[model samples]
Target chain A: MGNVSVSELRYIVGPSSYDSVGSKAMKVKKFLQDYFPSQDYLRRLGVCVFEAEANLAIHTTSGGDLLIVIYNNRVKVVAQDTGPGIPDIDKALTPGFTTAPEMARQLGFGGGVGLNNIKRFADSFWLESLKRGTTLVFEVWNDDSTQFDY
Target chain B: MKINEICKTVDAEILQSKGRLHIDIHTAFAADLMSDTLFIIMRDEDPLLLITGVTNLSVVRTASILDIPAVMIVRGKNVPPETIQLAEQNEIVLLRSKHIMFVVCGLLYKAGIQGVSWEM
Candidate 1:
């Protein structure tokens, strides 16, 4: 059961948000590219979603899950995890300050750039983590006719 | 220098990989911190060579998503067999250079491999 669109993508990752999991995001990108070959915004959307997936896997508990939703007008990525919440939003969102697990650092996901990079490419981003877990949402507006010159 | 040429010149033992070198790179920097490399290196440049001291699955993970095709693990250390296997799985060329990261990067630069203007 997924979103129904002329062309839509929804990816779900449960705690396997490692660097390897980026391929899941790529799968959606490939599907979208089949429809919009020259759409740069869609490409950008893929990059952000990949980062969010990495974030969820690196920071959240193993059973945590991340979801990427691609609709007709916008691509939204939601990463939710039943793991320890981020204690400091400001610092965690910084460009190079990461609290990622050591193993994640070795793989290159926690250069502390995931969120910032996601924010840089995404049109709107919201990250909320409470005692239960963290929920991150990233959206990118896509119309697929021209370049996004902003 | 071309990535293929760099591979030939150094005494780097291929750990895991096989793919045509699609792009030629001039200079490179080696570091364990993905943060430093992300800011310092040019992401768009293909066949960009990265030498890292980090020995973890994340190393391959970062390099793969970033599209870095060449990763040289330096120092006397070696990547775990699984990580090496993983690097191969991802189509990223993993090599073990007997030279330390600093020396390898310096030699490549001295031999005219190249370097992007790194800004702070």
Candidate 2:
């Protein structure tokens, strides 16, 4: 039998809600900072994870769950929402393309680089969307010896 | 420069210092868009500061996440009490300036604070 250890953290983000998103992201950030090798890697991960959470709060109608799983060598983040899914993920991933509302822009988000930023920072990225929702899964490796593929 | 010096340079009112005035910051990024700020800071190596016109909990929250030592809210915007409280809890310095974002950035740049840049 293969034995593995995993630790997980989760947060429920309400759609169109702003206040709780940052706090929840902070919780994840604190947890990662303690284990990640470099503050630089942790900062990059924090921004990507925060963007995912913010996207869920801004785009979805019903909000979503942000899940973080910590393994010995990597951290996996999953942001899933049950809302109107992205119709054009390819276009949506383009830099400076955003559907975030005026309120989100006013809060200094919606620069349209959320997903792009996520892709840039993650060691591996995956996205799945349907009429009901979207789920983004990304992993960041603790070992920084290799150059990032992004 | 130290947080106190930056506050004086911008003529900002120190809303909540959290005893962080002595902290040194070497780089500054001014933007109304937090996403852009977040993007730039992620790649920066020096101690970072944020100058913005948005005065909400998100500003403080973003700084807290990135471990940014201080934030200056430009254009004399009113920062809510809750925002200040969050800053204090995070040990982030929060200040408000009468000058606009552009002017605040200029002042900091002239004061030997370098701007943030991408890692590419």
Give the top-scoring candidate (lDDT).
2
What is the C-alpha local distance difference test score of each model?
0.67, 0.82
| Chain A TM-score, each candidate | 0.81, 0.91
What are the clashing pairs of model 2? A108-B34
What does candidate 2's lDDT look like per residue over A25-142, in tens digits? 7888887666765666677778878888999888999999999998876779999998699999999998889998998888787888889888887889999999898999998876
lDDT by residue (tens digit), candidate 2, B1-120: 887788889898899978467877888888888887767744344678888888888898789877788888899988889999989988988889999888888888898999876542
Model 1 alpha-carbon drift over 4 Å, by segment = A1-47, A61-63, A72-74, A101-109, A141-150, B27-29, B35-46, B116-120
**Which candidate achieves the best TM-score against the true structure?**
2
Q: Candidate 2's error at A59, in angstroms?
A: 0.5
Candidate 1 structure quality by residue, lDDT tens digits, A56-130: 666766545555565666667777877678898999877778887776666665778778777776778888988
Q: What is the TM-score of each candidate against the true structure?
A: 0.74, 0.92
Comparing to the true complex, what docking class would candidate 2 get? medium
Q: What is candidate 2's TM-score for chain B alone?
A: 0.91
DockQ of each candidate relative to the true complex: 0.27, 0.58
